[model samples]
Target: MTLDLQQRANRRMRRAVITLGVLVLVLVAALVVIALRGGDAPPKGAPAPQPSTTAPKPTATLPPDDGGYVAPAETVKLPDGATKSGDLPVKFPRTPDGAAAMAVASARNAWSLDPQRIRAGILAYASAQYRDQMAASADAGAKGNREFAGIPATGPVPAGATLNAWPIGVKYAAVDSDTVDVLVLLRVTHAAKTGTQPTTTLIVSPGRAVWEGGDWKGTATDPNQPLPDPVDIGTVGFNEDRWQAIQEGDRL
Candidate 1:
């Protein structure tokens, strides 16, 4: 009877262990199902997550620069026999070639028959060194200056003579890091002449320009040099108002 009781006790212990294992497996399966379904949602009355309240940082912006020159203020007398006041100085092309064009155009404007305009051009356009040289040459009664071209010691231009200089082409050579040599082909005409058909002079002017005051200042180092005969590139009407504008130091 004691042996039979020991067998029955062992059987009861085994059944208890199996029942515990089955309960543990059922609990693990329930947990896995809940995990796969993504846990429970928040209570229905809870507020939604608040958006960030801090302001966004502003992006940086730079001031605008056209890379061109701005003309200073001046008072100029217009060609219409009216004295006009200039509100702002003219702006020229900011590039090297553009600067060369302005230099030549201003030089051409200096050839006006008006004495005052001639003086103004010298003051407005020429380099400080060139200006001093021109003054010294004039005081010495020199014929002409290499830097100032056909401007005479006595007068800048002849009486009743007006010369219009237009550049046909421009070629630039780097003389050094700071200097440039420009070969400009120009057609010069005297529209004020009494002749029915005005003769024009096609010339090649070699100018040496140095960077000064944020712009290229050109001087006619070799004004007498003539190029090979050039073909007629046609002509345009001479506008006095445009001449006046250039005289007033406008960048064209």
Candidate 2:
């Protein structure tokens, strides 16, 4: 390839990667907003609840020797004939594993190349309490299937280019019988030209799933805390035990 052509390819690759990063940031911002604005404000003139004076019981903690890693204990079980709401999958089980599965699926669809698809995915997966808030912002400036979040949309893969993503790892915590928190790490690969090597980007996204109306639905993920930074797959700090490998059927 000519020098000019190579430079263009490099620019395209950079733009694609940046677009993915921006999409993640936008999603996070939306989640934070919903968390802050969700639920009813305290009734006018209502008294605040009193705090308990008794000391709380100690909860279990990971052993220091374990390097703060917690092995995945839940098993994902998808029901037969799992259905789809629009283009996004729906109807996961009610267990912690099911919540984790739904969370991963939500992240995958939220990053879709089509803005319409993204909007539909948000509507389908978001918890009822926050779904409208999330959907209203899903494609604020998107138009004509060419732009979303100010980046060029992935309409069709060119002859010499490719783009794909898959869930590689996950960490989950069951908050209660009706809620679960999940952190998912996705591996996104893109190439601007057939001969050029593909660039790999890692994205770690957190999601909360609430059991509502007999199924799991996505919600803001711990807005009081900051989101985790993305990390490379094989970095020294990466803990295999903490991030359980997502099975093929569960991946997107």
With candidate 1 superimposed using the best TM-score fit, by how many Å does residue 221's alpha carbon deviate from the native? 5.3
Candidate 2 lDDT by residue in tens digits, 1-252:
333543343333223221111112234322212222224342111111111111111111111243444334433343321778865668888888787777777655554434466567666676666556545654541221112111233345345654445666677789999888777777655555567566554555655678887778765443333434444334433453456666555441
Best by TM-score: 2
Angstrom error of the Cα, residue 217, model 2: value is: 1.2
Candidate-wise lDDT, in order: 0.33, 0.47
**Model 1: per-residue lDDT, tens digit, 14-62?**
2322111000011111121122122234111111111101111111111
Displacement of the residue 179 alpha carbon in candidate 2, Å? 0.6
> What's every prediction's RMSD, in angstroms?
42.2, 14.7
Error of 1 at 226 (Å): 9.0
Per-model TM-score, in order, reads 0.42, 0.58
